[model samples]
Target chain A: MIEGHDLDYVVSGIQTLHRVSIRAEAGEIVCVLGPNGAGKSTLFRLLSGEIAPRAGKVTLLGHDVTTTPKDTLATMRAVMPQESVLSFPFTAFEVVMLGRTPHATAGETMADRAIARAAMAATDSLAYEDRTFSSLSGGERQRVTAARVLAQIWEGEEGRALLLDEPTSSLDLLHQHGLLETATTMAERGCAVVCILHDLNLAARYATRVVVLQEGRKVAEGTPREVLTRALLADVFEVDARIFVPEGTEIPVVVPRGPLSKTKPPRLATGALL
Target chain B: MTMAEAPTSRPTPRAVARPFAWATSRSFVLAAGCLVVALSVVLGCAVGAVHVPPLEVLQSMLGLETPHREMLMSIRFPRVALGLLVGSGLGLSGASLQGVFRNPIVDPGFLGISTGAVLFAVVAVVLGGHGAVSTMRTALGAPLLLSAAAFVGALVAMLSVRWLATVEGRLSLTALLLSGLAVNTVAGALTGVLLYAATDVQVVTVTFWTFGSLGGATWGTVLRVAPIFALGLVTLPRLGRSLDALVLGDAEAGHLGIPVERTKLLVIVVSALLVGAQVAVSGLVGFVGLVIPHVLRLWAGASHKTLLPASALFGAALVVLADTSARIVVKPAELPLGVITAALGAPFFLALLLKERRRLV
Candidate 1:
């Protein structure tokens, strides 16, 4: 479990996060959706204990993370950053084995190796275990990094959280679903999972709960059906969209009607607003 | 896909598969490095002004007195030991620095560290004001003063470079390398002024050191420098995991439970100790650090767990071989150790640069 209360963060004298509060519990997938610079990464950083929030408290597994030692917090949560830039030519296996660093006191143990390999296999990256990380394609590299963080929390019990920043950005459609499916499995095994994503339908399909952000503040928070309405998209994303609900489903499938034109206003099928 | 039966009982993929992958296996490279180092140590002991055979060298070393025993014990042994020590120090320091910086091109002297040490050494020589030969013998007597001066100089320069490159606790590699360039130029200018003010004998002494040499190798100097090198060797191996984690960059390394700032400090301090100590004893033996670690990485892969130690072995071997060549290549008159190292290093470096030309431009 992870909770952020009224979190405020400043970067380079500019307020990037403004009194943001959010929480994640075990067995749930929470997706944060926003435009560029919506403080999604900043929020992840604060939750991961990389930076302290000026105005709020962040607690992980009931301990105040601001004062908690990083090594102690490490075993409870794993964070996969936006980009993993490496100059050294480490094999994918070696890169993932780095995830077991916090646990292993000396060199790697047999158990650590098993966990790393299992995580790689889970991410469908076992085929590239011998390949150098730098030689992998973008999607492959992203998945390998995901495997690394997964290996970090592979054996943890409840109260563990996985924070992913744009995990599927480089992934193709099928791989995107596969990555989210893996995250869902992780949640099923009693882990709190939070992902920041750009695609709305993906969020609607995978996220049990969604939080919408505009600029740096949270505008709406609820289940995917309640929060991702046509009105919310228009007001927050500044776009005209059609919301489609297929039969026997409550999940909203959003279809964009292009940008809100200045010369010619948006047309609605209802015809009342025009 | 179905979950595996026992998650924890999965195959140990790292060991079970690609068992001979030289890059990832630590023991193989370490064993090879030890073997090569052992061969080079024997070779260093054998090939000198007097070409004692390897069997004779071993026999003399094991207390079986040969006709060349006196020469072997007095001149060749101390020189070989010092070469091993200094070479290992330089190699390990360079590897650690490159790992911390996450740039293969970096060396122990990357932050103008060696320049600072050279500046202080030149200052000590100019202030001593004696004949080059006499100064060389006695400077080893004031080992504390000289080593302290060099260490302080390196620490100050490194800190300044760090200060210049750091903003709000985050380090910028671009700024760090640029500041290193700036500091090196200023130190070079200072050294030039000292050289200009020096007497003729002092000029000769300063010039000898600036070009770097192991001609002054003695048991006393080797003993004086050993403890510092030992300190670095002890600290570096423990940093293997953190350095490996650092390949992912600072922020991500921290996420992996490494204290990034502390690790960087530890690397800098150990690097300074090793480089400063080597400069204090052997002057600036160029490229042993840069060339050895790179060759090892190219041949055996870039795992720092082995890269750091293997570099020490290869570096010691190369230096020993080069120093041995320095003695015999010009029989009666020995070449400066630095010249020989540069002769070997320059071509290898050029080859590497040509191979990496696309990235360089």
Candidate 2:
């Protein structure tokens, strides 16, 4: 379904993502895995039209979106940012209602609310529908934000895009897997879901194709078994990782090669990552 | 808090919220229209010593066959009309500025726009530039110079704020508000300095201008400020959706297909024109823009499509009603419109903030 001449994305003039180019086919979950500051978020912003490329073309659904209007850029493409904190307190239902912006007259068919409810239900956030969004926990907020993005896309509509910029960054393990499960479900529904992941294991498990970014460049692109090798992890990520292939599964299990150092350097204290 | 806690509350359910919303929407418009009509006639009846009945005031206002109505109609009707025009203009302009800034705390005056206008208008009045020694000095000169000085002052202030606020192709809220505060402080200092140097009569004239009055309201003032208000009224309603999107933040507004930069420009320009014309006539009347929107938003959700028009109407009604009370409260004597606005606005605003203590800063 993704049939654009420039299906690949080219990000230039940046530190690391200057020469990155990648493409994922229709109905596939494409995950980008890289170390911190690998510019995964930058690449996603370019694709989402939040940041303009210095010298590149981003085509979506066969249309040149290099300079497309934000409203018309991707009617079905939804971006769930890292965190959705509002200065004003808006209800969860109200926050989710923003996803219907692309739809005309803001019509609320039974099916639309059902999709929002279903997304929330999948994330175990159905109870949050009538609650103030500000009062939700971090993990619950992420789920609500994910539900909002799901609402952005028209159901059963082809050529829809889901751009997740580290949706599980602030989530617990359970919520993290739950979010990925929802993303996989969305891809099963024929969405071209692209997510940036900090966890290599997550990329290997759910991603049909894993694109690795070194600096601002695309280093490797292939299936979990093809790209998630020990040498590739060490060479690209500068950290050794062990790839395990269990029986009766095409996906490989990824474990970082380090002994998992917990001690912080004397000069720096362990702090929460922003 | 639900309506059960407040007996007088007119709470409309969500199922029938639409029609009640429509009625609340038109109530302000209807109130403003009625106020204008009633005040014009009441103003005609309010000559020096005698109290003209509403009917006699109307007859005199129309120039029908009446023996002594000529002086009342010719002299007082202009004052009343000017008051209405200035009041309506100020209220609407303040509403637009509040909407554009997306901050309920914003008023047209808070940005120092009115200070600039008042400064120039005061200077014009002090200098007696309308041929102070001219024959029709009292009636003609005030409106002419006041409106002119006001427009020029407003343009400069807005242009300065716009220049200060714009950085890297976007208006930074922090910078915009900070610059406004700075300019307001400076302009206020200058106005105070000017007040000290004025002659006794000039001081009184400028004092009235600062405090605000429709006593000097005139047809010529209306003619000058009318088109500005008309343009603001027309252009602001179309920006509702854009403003609604802006509440989500600039990036979000952009993502929603609204032309953010263009929308900001239009809002700033129209708001400036409204404030400029209003200040030229009535001087600086604070808090209507700030308070009115907060009031409406509590009732209506933060939807700009409903908020802007509703704020405009409610702002007009509030100001006009304030002006009416200013006229009749003291009976033979009159209070400056500013005093009335402040007296009414301050307590109400405080209560509003208190009621929503959870949301207050």
Candidate 3:
């Protein structure tokens, strides 16, 4: 449902993403994994239409993202940004209700409210519906934001896309799994789900496919068992790691030993620490 | 948290009940705001030097014959109407501008509209003729000239700020605030220069204009400013949903399908026009814009749909009441409308800041 072709993104004349291409078809959970500064976020930004790639095209749900109007794109896809800061004192429920803006005609309707509530329930955030969003804990706020995006595409059928960027960063252990499970459920519902993740085991468990990036280049793309190897981990992530598959299970579990002695500090594509 | 959650279910009763509660409360607040506006209008018309009773004012409003018919219709009614328009316009402008900038502290003054108007009005006082007295007489003779000068000055400042703040076709909020600050400082400095060079009478006129008053409200002035205020009243409230989306930073608002740049531009232009016309008619009325919306946000949650209209109604009532007190507090001598509002609003604003200091930090 979402695809990028020969994407080349340059920042300050330095190539951040070089000839990278990725796609997530309907009913597929494509998890993108990379170390810090591996151009994963730059790729996500290009696909989400937050920034335009310098030399490529992004197609979402059969339309070119660059030429399509934002309102039209919004109805077909929902993006959960890394962080959301509400300037006003909106309640958690009110924050989720904003996701209905694309479908709402005049104001919020009973159906919109119902869908928003269902989304909040799905994310387990309904308990704090009346709490001020800013007053919520970080994990609670992340769940509320997740519900917002889920509410956005709640009514849509096939051909929908959900793009999540580091959604589990502030989540606790249980919620991290819960949010990925939600993404898996969305994929099962025939929505294209593309998530950028740091937890390799969670990605291995939940993702139908994986795309690994290293230094602005795609190094591997395959199933969890095919792509995740100890040598690949050493080469790309600069870490000594072991990949073990439990009995009767095709899922690969990654266990890190330690960082390689030649590990280089991650640097932005612009060569600036900032 | 569940290991494997069930499929999404219907909202629980608690989930359904709270929104309904807010809905009912919002309606109640709106109704109360209407009542407040009505009471203030009647009280303002009745409490002047003549002391026309409320029953008499109501009868006059209903077109019945009364002893104070001419005084009520010609003088008090127009003054009240002007107050209603200017106050509501300022209130609406402040709320929408705050939404666009995603900052609660911003107001029309942050756009330099008030300073620009003051500077231009002072210039018209000092340099419009041979001496300050002749210019004052001319201004009294033809009020449009001064109003037009002030409006033009406001437009100039708005355009300059817009130009300076635009970076590659997008409005940068930080750049906008910095440019507005720069414009205000320059205008204030120029006004200071004019004040330093002015005669005593000219200085008094300039100072009084800065203090703001509704004493100059006439039928002509009311009619002249009505269309602009009406334009704002019609357009600003319609932006409630867009403004709500904008409270989340611009990028997220865009993800929700809002045309963030266009919305920001529209808000800036409309707010500038509203504030410019207000300053043109009534000299720099302070704090009604900032305090009205902030208070409304605290009372009725921050949904712009409810906050915008509520601010308009309560702001109208507050200004009408303030103007009434301005006329009657000192009996024959009157305080400036701006003075009364500042005296009331500044302390309230300080208290609010103190209460919200932790959140702000």
Among all candidates shown, the one with the greatest DockQ: 3
Model 3 over residues B164-250: C-alpha lDDT tens digits?
Answer: 988986566667778889998999899999987777777766776678888867887788778878888888888888899988777
lDDT for model 2:
0.68
Flag regions of model 1 displaced more than 4 Å. A262-274, B1-24, B109-111, B128-134, B162-178, B355-361
Ranking by DockQ: 3, 1, 2
Cα deviation at A271, candidate 2, in Å, is: 19
> Which pairs of residues collide in candidate 3?
none
Global local distance difference test of model 1: 0.82
| Residue-wise C-alpha lDDT for candidate 2, range A1-274, written one tens digit per residue | 3322222334343344565676656678899888777778777777777666665566777665555666775365777788865544456766776666565334446766656655555656666576678788888888778777777774755677788888888888877877787777678677888889888888888899988887666788899889988888767766656788999988888887563234323444457443
Candidate 3: residue A171 lDDT (0-100): 89
Cα error, candidate 3, residue B262 (Å) = 1.1
Q: Report the error of model 1 at residue B9, Å.
A: 20
TM-score-better candidate, 1 vs 2: 1
Tell me the tens digit of each residue's lDDT in model 2 across B171-286: 56667767888888888788788767666666666666678766666566667667778888888876776776666666666665667779888887777677767776676687
Best by TM-score: 1
- Tens digit of lDDT per residue, candidate 1, span A1-274? 7999999888789998888888989999999998888888889889888888989999988899878887887788899988787778788988999999889857789999988878887777777887889899998899899899999998867988999999998888877887888888889888999899999999999899998877789889999999988888888877889988889997889898876675356556796766
Q: State the displacement of the C-alpha of residue B153, model 3, in Å, after optimal TM-score superposition.
A: 4.1
TM-score of chain A of each: 0.93, 0.86, 0.95
lDDT of 3 by residue, A1-274 (tens): 7999999999988998989999999899999999999999999989988899899899997799888999998888999988888768999999999999999847789999988887887887888898899989999999999999998998767989999999999988877877888887888787999999999999899889999999899999989899999999999888999999999998999999988877756646884656
